[model samples]
Target chain A: MAVYTDITESELGAFLRDYNIGELLSYKGIAEGTENSNFILHTTGGTFILTLYEKRVDRDDLPFFLGLMDHLAQRDVSCPLPVKRADGEIIGELAGRPAAIITFLEGMWPRRPTTAHCREVGVALAKLHLAGQDFPLQRRNDLSLPGWQRLWDGCRERCDEVEHGLEAEVSDDFAALEAGWPADLPSGVIHADLFPDNVFFLGERLSGLIDFYFACNDFYAYDVATCLNAWCFERDHSFNITKGAALLAGYQSLRPLDAAEVEALPLLCRGSALRFMLTRLYDWLHGPDGAMVQKRDPLEYVRKMRFHRQIISATEYGLQQS
Target chain B: MAVYTDITESELGAFLRDYNIGELLSYKGIAEGTENSNFILHTTGGTFILTLYEKRVDRDDLPFFLGLMDHLAQRDVSCPLPVKRADGEIIGELAGRPAAIITFLEGMWPRRPTTAHCREVGVALAKLHLAGQDFPLQRRNDLSLPGWQRLWDGCRERCDEVEHGLEAEVSDDFAALEAGWPADLPSGVIHADLFPDNVFFLGERLSGLIDFYFACNDFYAYDVATCLNAWCFERDHSFNITKGAALLAGYQSLRPLDAAEVEALPLLCRGSALRFMLTRLYDWLHGPDGAMVQKRDPLEYVRKMRFHRQIISATEYGLQQS
Candidate 1:
């Protein structure tokens, strides 16, 4: 567990003096993350999660993550609500790290989530898109096309050393993508990393959503493509058509995608897969040398990139003609 | 560009004093990583890439990365050979960062790598495993099983907040995987990141391999599984049996996998996918703010995870019974 900061029970109680969340009964470090230290705090009022930002996270971005949760909660997005301190500040300092307290959401992360669960998540994600429509914040997807090229440049030398011709091929693909990137689309806040582990459920229904760290302004349908790439695969990495249909149908039910958005699904999915492949490749090339955080295999995303590359036709993504 | 140390051309030239390489012609910053600053150095001797270790990479690991490259080169592995100083020193200090000079490989990364390309990569990877059979190094796959759980613990809270129920599912999967992990398997040096970007090609023939950063000791077949996950997927992130067959055949032609290895392929593939999914998920939850690095959609790996989950039958992975 990445414990950027450690806090004792008494220390946490002193920190919670400003919040209205009653007395802190107990707190323990929740071992998880590559960036921050997390503590599950049980108080007289209720349970809450206290996060202490580590080196990986920028101090300035705390408001965006915390504020988004607060905003989403106010809009009934079924997520953790950030608790502001008595000084009306949501962000605070704890254990020598930037910290914030959020209401502990009740429910469990589903282990055997079904296709129906995926569909529900799809619908919920669409709802989140809708709910975040008028959010006052304006953060762009900084890690989009340009960011990809930057990463490619960083690992280009070593890239060819591992796999033959990977650098040139990816460069060519990236050039093509850059040459013809989509311009106009229905854009809004996108939950960039809506993986199954980031969601909580009560049975087949989605109880809540968590982790708004990657939420940024981007094409809404791209989020759907991400979901399809995530929730519609069988055990052999084969596309599960039934699950795909359910997920798509569920998304369309809430926020009907524009024709342009639908048409761009395949390309977006490809771009999305490439985005991951590049990041994973970069990390694989230069992840931390430590016993704490393990380096990820970049090949998984490489497979995803190949799959997205195959999705040449719009129909392949089950989208109708624009 | 993440230049941990900003040195002038003269400073860099002075730093390259004892190297076998000739005078530096030019150096340009490659703005492309979260861990290190890379400069493509043009010298009278040849074009080389100079990497300056940044925050994410430990300075101590410089020896490992450099030594591994030297070892592979000595064993006839087509890799980027680390350049040593005239004083027989491989490590150096540049701009207050641990730095090294390495030969720049020539080739393109396959954008639309075919089944043939997959086969060649498989063969080369197998050969790499064979070459490393007696290497003096013994780096364990720290990212294998326990590392995943550690990451899960760090990101569990924000994980649910991001995707909903994904945390529990991942945890359960991790637990199940831990309970039945393969106790015994042939272990050796594996190029864990066998992605297309990591493989270099000079036309139809395989030229070289890059990115040995994730290379470590593990089941040799796990490397094959990593290749399959990377190279056997169609554009829609779906499995392609033809590609899979070619890749496997190529691997067998060089170093055939045993019965136990074949039987373990499916689980290893699943485990490989899960490893990536978890890491990507962690990055999604706690990506650095304003950094050039892109956070890959964790959902893509979620689909991959699902696919691996469905591979309950050994026959599904083209394994034959002994």
Candidate 2:
């Protein structure tokens, strides 16, 4: 209930004293987030975001998250660069949580992002995946297919209580997904949560990307699946063919997906949709009582899962013939 | 963190003692939900679901939720029936939370729900609207056109942090929706969340409906919008015209839509999709961070919203000329 991490002006000043960055002039908590507690710090030299790892974030993964920023920044990717300490460590302990300070990149996350936005995002995402090809550290997508089933298994008995036979149907769908899991596609580090909010833009151009929490080594096409599910639709929750076309073209223009990747897109999109649906469904079924978190209607994703379920045929997603 | 409410064997026995209808043989906590704590109770008479209101549920609204069930049941609509307690009250206190017991209908929520299922759901939904014509409660959809802008305003500042210019576009859409808001359409209570998980089926027939938390008085065609968003889509999140046809035909068979309703279908669908996208977008901006509640990719709905945005003409939704 108490403030999990409270860094006063003096405390933050002392915290940054050991860092190579110039004198810290001002710092305050950014109240607009639900995940990590972020403080926008304005120093004599520059501006940066100081994030204190929250409950949802694994402390052990702080290095990976911070190191990823450093790595991506070094690769000329327009992303936040982790400000290292004098000891050369990118992460630090503050307010009893793993913390890091990173130079804030310019540009805003697109609000009314247009089809052109989707296209640029697709291109940028492909480039990010390529840039991550040689990144040192590796983490598996723990919330992938198998992980989803395990979570569902935990909530199976309760499923019937919420809606009669919801458990059985979910089980069947999971089984089907498992049985048809794609094999031997191009694999690499992917920004698995490439939602529009995570991607920043200046004018019509994509400026940078953020939120690497779900970034992991996975099938390259799955990232495209994530994008198609994210960017191709408008505010009304309907599919836009023009946007879909532009996005796919942009992605292909950058990375040029092979025949297998193109073939796997529809299924991958379905899997991506199901992945979120199952997770959201699980959360809907078992979120802790009286928590500050607002629970989303799992039925929304249920509709999405159903939409994806119908995409069994390759032509359903309008994938260009390889 | 410890179990918030523990309904032990003796406690549940005492709780069920006053109910007049059936013999309580067995009761168990149903763990598959994120909203309310549910128990599947098998009595000498029949099976029922005992739902304990959780945090997200407003205790005051228990009457609306429970009464709607009773109202629907009285109208010969297939839905759960709320059981009255010995005190002549439908609502009761359990585990320091508002609670109620309702008859559990037979059938599954449909995992791989087919196009046939979509048609059946459309028909059932139409029947539900017709049956709900004279229901006493006068609740309006809290998430209607204006409600969306209100939510958008609350989260607009942080909107830049997620999707760029979503705030402005949503505002513009709201203006457009308001300028052409439909009036003089047939009015009725609509099951606003008609997703596959909320509809139950026995073999090929729809046996019952659940989750009327979003039911409200609105233009009848809005229900169709909800359905088109829920059904008539393949798993890959693309619209399926064949499925759409079946669903429309089925609904028309139950209660034929008026010309105005048909004319408004595309915008209504767009409105419905935007409603969900905004809700999901708000959640993405300000939802709780936990291992359980996975943030839905807002971009999925974003893509859906965009599709709806492109539908400037009624012909886009395939409405036949009256």
Q: lDDT of all the models against the reference?
A: 0.75, 0.73
Where does model 1 exceed 4 Å of error? A1-322, B1-5, B31-34, B318-322
Docking class of 1: incorrect
What DockQ does each prediction reach against the true complex? 0.01, 0.01
Best by TM-score: 1
The 10-residue segment of model 1 chain A with minimum total lDDT is A1-10
The best candidate in terms of lDDT: 1
Q: Could you tell me how far off, in angstroms, the CA of residue A47 lies in candidate 2 after the best superposition?
A: 62
The CA-based lDDT of model 1 is what? Answer: 0.75
Candidate 2 residue runs with Cα over 4 Å from true position? A1-322, B1-6, B21-25, B31-33, B288-291, B312-315, B318-322
Candidate 1 lDDT tens digits, B27-72: 5444333467666666668677788877666666666667887888
Candidate 2: docking tier: incorrect
Candidate 1 versus truth, CA RMSD in Å, comes to: 28.6
